[model samples]
Target: MIGDEVQVAFTKYDGSPHWHIGTRLLGEDEHGTWLHSPAGTFTWRPGLAFTYDRANVLCVPRGQHWAATLYDGGGASAVTTYVDITTPAVWSAGRVTMSDLDLDVVQRVGEEPFVDDEDEFELHRVRYAYPPELQAQARAASAAVLAAVTARQAPFDGATAARWLALAEPAWTPVAPPARPAG
Candidate 1:
């Protein structure tokens, strides 16, 4: 995983339709890996979605107990950044895959810490027919990520991400604008 460019993706527990295509790989350490995504990504749900560009991901490669920091480049989206607390990820030399827990801790430059996606979570609760125990776990995961992000916890503190960003600069590739989905 470290020192290799890997395909990074996030999916629902059952590998349903929802996903997050990543910024590509730069490198990693004990804390986690840094994904340099110059091109913003499209986040979708059934139909509606938005793209967030100029972002990077600092991800812990743990499955079912993983977390990530999404540092936005602040292009068009109002969200400056977010922390996705999730199930641990499957990180390998070939790819990185994480499961979404339906909760996000979002941050803006001058705004209070915000929790986004409870509605989405509830929607998925019925849609995915999530078990009670699993739903509870997802909620707990959300709380953990929020606490870490709000407290500026290690690795989540931005220092590791910053260092990785500086390292990734020389290796960055300019991606063409992503193709828009057909109407």
Candidate 2:
């Protein structure tokens, strides 16, 4: 449903929790399922919890190893776009999940897009024992996403996100994520 709330969860390669957030279903397109997270939407991790300061639209592309969140800039962080290289998303009744590969492609306002978190990715690759094939896939996905974002490709271009955000803003309501389990 267009206005239904959905939980988006991420896990590490070893299956530990990474991030979980709530978003509203903002419909789908040729690209994939689009989700809307308005400002103040709660996000949770193992020992962290906070709300986003700016609205963003997340696109979970079908059968793709990467998912993207396009932000409406001018917030405390200048990050205008973030694409996570991950395993293909698994979708269920009211939730979606993916294993974060740690390599991220980011584009900050007015700056060239680049691949971020390579150090974390390298550390985790050894720590998690990511297979050679998986490592290759992650690296390839990061490079591809960085290029697309730099070229202002559709969806990464903000035009697609703007349309979905417009549809969602009017009916948007704040939704809290499930409470994080005590350590």
Candidate 3:
């Protein structure tokens, strides 16, 4: 049974057009008809393609720049298992890679703002603003993490990757959910 939804946003190479890539979800309605989110209510139609198959352009694979997060009717978080549509319009045999993604912690924890003369500050409860440099570092770190997983065909180590990425990009924030209600 489909449990959750994965949303990915992708833009063209030249920064022109963009579209969303969404995962298919299976749910039972109050009336017992199987309803598919993003596709509206529908029953078995033998020859008709499934929602996911019809929205094949959205899935991106390794090497593609994309923002992705998963929702469990709750909120967004890092994703692990995802349908890979990473290959360009040439490949025919599509596959899903179950590599773990380790979210970077520094990005998770964010950055600390320090006063010019202040040497020490409170440890845990401190609230600070992330500088622009930090945010860039974080993005670079994220790219590195993606590269590694692609090379090793493994999941990212969340804490380390997050920390490294956070070092560069202080503006590490998780993807925000769309304002529209989930279907």
Candidate 4:
């Protein structure tokens, strides 16, 4: 099922070393799909990757980024939602993948939704070697996300996610995943 717990992964910002691990599909809609963990997971990414790794204590195994809330999902909470912002996720049956577009939306209880690590975005833009086309796309997408988040649009406003959270509650029934033929 699309919303079921499955192992998945994405490229590091540098776009090498493809690694797919575990997380839930959450749900999907016109806005896009969401990946989440009730207790975050450790996403292995380097600081140079411009990934959000605040208060990182684990780095020996690999230069790790803390996803302190991703170990599991399908649970709903109004407080402390670590919404990962990417180029959206593409799903096929029980599998999923997305680009690490280098920005994440952290929606907490009372605070306004804010995009994390914009500095990382700029730093990586110069530090790493992103192709010109992907560079343009990333900049445009990042800007658009910032603008929409600033404007509090739809899902970014907290309303849509909140609604989804309610729907993801344990008692809520999950539907059979839709067929995602390879395009």
Which candidate wins on lDDT? Answer: 2
Give model 1's TM-score versus the native structure: 0.75
lDDT of 1 by residue, 113-174 (tens): 66798998789778877788878877887777677667877666767676766665555553
Badly placed stretches (over 4 Å) of model 4 are 17-21, 39-88, 104-119, 126-128, 171-183
List the candidate 2 regions with Cα displacement exceeding 4 Å. none
lDDT string for model 3 (1-183, tens) is 432443332322232223333333233322111112231212122233222211111222333322222112211322322222111222222212221111221112133211111121122012333244533443454555345544432222333223222222222222222233233
For every model shown, what is its TM-score relative to the native structure? Answer: 0.75, 0.96, 0.22, 0.55
lDDT of 2 by residue, 99-154 (tens): 99999998887799999899999999999999999999899889888888888989
Error of 3 at 118 (Å): 35
Q: How many residue pairs clash in all the candidates, one count each?
A: 10, 0, 20, 9
Cα misplacement distance, residue 121 of candidate 1 (Å):
1.1
Instruction: Give the C-alpha miss distance for residue 62 in model 3, angstroms.
Output: 18
Ranking by TM-score: 2, 1, 4, 3
| Of 3 and 4, the candidate ranking higher by TM-score | 4
Off by over 4 Å in 3: 1-18, 25-131, 156-183
RMSD of each: 3.7, 1.1, 20.0, 10.4
lDDT of 1 at 161: 70
lDDT of 4 at 135: 65
